[model samples]
Target chain A: MKISEIGEFGFIDEIKDNTLFNPDPVVIGIGDDGALYKTTQGMEQIAVIDTMVENSHFIIGRTGEWYDVGYKAVASNLSDIAAMGGIPTHIVLSTAFRPDMDVDDVIALYKGIKDICRTYKVNILGGDTVTSQEGAVITVAAFGEIEAGKALLRSGAQAGDVVAVSHTIGNSGAGLDVMLHGADGYDELKKAHRFPEPQIALGRLLVKHHCHSLNDISDGLASEANEIAKASGVRLVLQYEDLPISEELQRWAAASGTQAGKFVFTGGEDYELVFTMSSADFAQLQAEFPAVTTIGTVEAGPAEVVLCQGGKRELLPAAGWTHF
Target chain B: MKISEIGEFGFIDEIKDNTLFNPDPVVIGIGDDGALYKTTQGMEQIAVIDTMVENSHFIIGRTGEWYDVGYKAVASNLSDIAAMGGIPTHIVLSTAFRPDMDVDDVIALYKGIKDICRTYKVNILGGDTVTSQEGAVITVAAFGEIEAGKALLRSGAQAGDVVAVSHTIGNSGAGLDVMLHGADGYDELKKAHRFPEPQIALGRLLVKHHCHSLNDISDGLASEANEIAKASGVRLVLQYEDLPISEELQRWAAASGTQAGKFVFTGGEDYELVFTMSSADFAQLQAEFPAVTTIGTVEAGPAEVVLCQGGKRELLPAAGWTHF
Candidate 1:
């Protein structure tokens, strides 16, 4: 069987079962945003690695700049830590590129990385630089820390838990469309696609408020919700009208003859937090984070997601971006 | 300027100058096999990442099995921690490959990783698998731990220190030649190339023996020796006759009409350790590890390495493998 038959998540599931040889230090091993391992008496270290291949993740010169490529690479890894409600502390970066690549472009890439590291107070550790046969490949391995038992996992949602998102969804997806199709007026969408900010502060706040489940919107809300549902062995019911789609994305979708809800559900790389919590906790959190919008609720049922519109319900397929 | 103009080490030098945004936790940052950072009051964490591109590092199915590729990837990262005299505990693996690759082959790759992780008692934490447009790329980020002050560094060598290596050198280089040229009657050399072992035990022993500077022979003996000399700000005089050369490698080199010293000096990926220590400590370590061989001595002079043979001395240039 080809790996494409299994898909990315299926490939992960295939390798995830027998990975921990010495399981003593591992609090949470494979199949999470990051691996959580016991470090000190009351602290756990989270390690996550993400790789962006040329053309697969971004077009260096065309997407925005080499700086933007570097920025997005670090942002995506930081988002994983945010999904785990952890404080990112350090990162090691590996870049594989052609020898003929300009040194100034590489320096610009590092400048983007350095700026983000400074903003997050993350130290740049050591990494490898090697020659690639073709396009460049950048991999960042990020390390973070969280208090013991304070991590928000994908498997903690309970029936009646309210599902919410930290920011308006689909802006990035519309931004990508704008960049690709040359839609003249959507600077907000273009910037959203170019430079995403990981929701670290919101993640910490959710964990403090005892959020039940959390995921980062790297693979879109539909796929992320399905992951939470499967991991938690529950059903998610998302209200179609309740999804927080941005005005710019909606307007762009209307002008382009596309569905805004499609972007909200299946367009990935938003870098926003999607989480579940008790209704009371959601209410308390909404006051502190006014932009947080309720989109769904957890239910005790088969592991799947459903989208409800007006008076009809339909299954939400996990059609989010899969590499394979 | 193109990165190739400055070369791999030059590119590293370019990025090494300013990386640490938060300097408190960092004990050592760039320009080393691994980054060492303070994790707890008395413990430091060692993190290293290595990437292997398809044609650059290994050609799948051409250079042994897919298993060998996976094993070597993890082995290379583990070797970095070994160079730091740390106990490797965990690793995160990332792979970018064509989606049409066989699932069984990927499983075989993971089996190789699993086998090595079990042998070292290191846990497979988490990783990212993505689609690459071209040939496969594998990256491994390894983490290890060492006592606060017991970690060996490349800058600790002093004048009068003895330089030694844990095992005979150039076997892997010979093995690569055997594989590439289809040379017969050298199974040992082939095995050395296919499955190079990290010198973790020897590294631990060296640290216990208060060994000073240390490096793994991934970029040949001359390059590693030069790194030690430069980092420690001392001159090293290597006795050419005392350099350990395997009998098989020597015989093979003779049969192939190639000088065996060429491989000994510039053949990389050996994974054995080269280290320095006070003469007294070297004597003590030799008693415990009889295979260890003294090949050189540190001298008070400019940071450089000299090859001495038959009362003649010549400068040794770092003509090891550069990715470019």
Candidate 2:
């Protein structure tokens, strides 16, 4: 059945029925003007919102399933909360639906959202749904909590801090290219693109290890590094040889005759945590998280990012995906 | 200049400059993955999201100014919080913009949002801005706080409760008609449609007076009353003659040969609080809020609504706006 037949309230009722995972802290959930929830004393609140527009963020049934679209929408917002060094507790979802859209696809979208929230122990609070004239738009507002004055910020990096990333990068961008170009093989790359995991555990570990600065690789490593450098008023020098590139991504790029570094620097939506800390802290963290890799160092200089390769140095432009 | 010239981050910088009205609770504002704020002890949190799409909620530069669109977007969410008997504290705005759109128009929209937020002493947290393939889409997620266990809900109206509204209704609907049809007179009605205020004070007062149930009128009286009736499992009987219709609306309906009651029952976007309470409590509330009008009563019956006029009664259909 088309969404037009079900109407706005009917669709909302469907969402209400499917949502409500992790409802312990929730006094009110869906079917209200606003949702009410209990707050723990002395804890700081973190809120973030992310929107995924159809045809721009994803092409339904082409790039991935509607389920993937829903899953990624929640993942993106959760990643933001993770970047803040917080534990996500609840989310509110807002959507703009086209009248002629199929109801089953929308339900699948909610199923994906529900599954993710359930996995993360996050409650679906409330959201708004309205009719749109064209493609669907999904916006998720996520809320998390952190200890008082313990949020990880981009402006906390100091000179002599070591820069590290949670895991290998550029796989998501490579996966997108594989889907868009319809290249055969590389199932792992495709899965990386379709289901990028939020680095919530790594973020908490970084905070516990006293990491000074943090950012998520949503707009590529280049842009995220620049953001940290500018916010902290320090320079970041990345070793090109040390940049973490997955073996699968390297093979896919080499087979496709593409430069792997291009995806590493400019590819977006990797959903990995890039952070800075002292060398001693990094050593302790790397012992616990064996996959974490150090690729850069902070220096006392103008706010900038530089790449070093073969004893050569060059400035890195803040080039990534520009929405406009 | 078009937004495409400056890019997405550039537009975000402009918004970052204009926001930040109340900064006491904000630990981290804009320019981050997520915003952080301190939560007060012993207070519950409230969250709601509302979206406005071009040619759907309002026609920019025609039905209202871009500023009004922005103002109403925040007002709608604020009204939701008010219905829950909470004090709005922070908001995150998410917009999907057409790249070719003029930057000045978007700035005006933010100006509207800024002014309303300033009036309410609410802080602008952070949001996401993306490129849409079509017209502008604005979604605002509002956060508020109320005392523990004191939020007003829709399912609390018991039998023998009186149904009341905060103020006159149907003016906004008449105003929209005037603008859509290009009628010569009714400037007051036009203003009503352009700038509807959220009844925050009345909502707080209702909670103070121990009102049983509450809802905001966004989808007209018939629909909102039906929601309350169904949620509370009680029947509502509204006296047609007792609905608080503004004199200007009555004049416009008479001049335009339209039924004023039609607008009262089926028109939406009034943003007034409609609630139910015992007659004794209602008397106490009415003494302080003279503008509050009694139009109905809750009766022990199956969930339904009946309109009574001149010794005749008819079932009131839940016919308002159907988004799909």
What clash pairs does model 1 have? Answer: none
Candidate 2 all-Cα RMSD: 2.5
Interface C-alpha RMSD per candidate, 1 decimal: 9.0, 0.8
Q: For candidate 1, write residues B1-324 as lDDT tens digits.
A: 432345434433442333333445443343211233445545567778888888888876556788998889999888988998888877777888776666566666767777787788776666677778777899999887777667787878899999999989999988888788866679889888889999888889998899988989998899889988888899989998998898899889898888888888888899999999999999899898899999999999999999887788888877742211
Which stretches of model 1 miss by more than 4 angstroms? A1-41, A320-324, B1-41, B320-324
> What would you estimate as the lDDT of candidate 2?
0.90
The superposed Cα distance between candidate 1 and the true structure at residue A133, in angstroms, equals 2.0
Candidate 1 whole-model C-alpha lDDT, 0 to 1:
0.79
Question: For model 2, which pairs clash?
Answer: none
* Residue A48, model 2: Cα distance from true site in angstroms: 0.5
Please list, in the order the candidates appear, how each scores on TM-score for chain B only. Answer: 0.86, 0.96
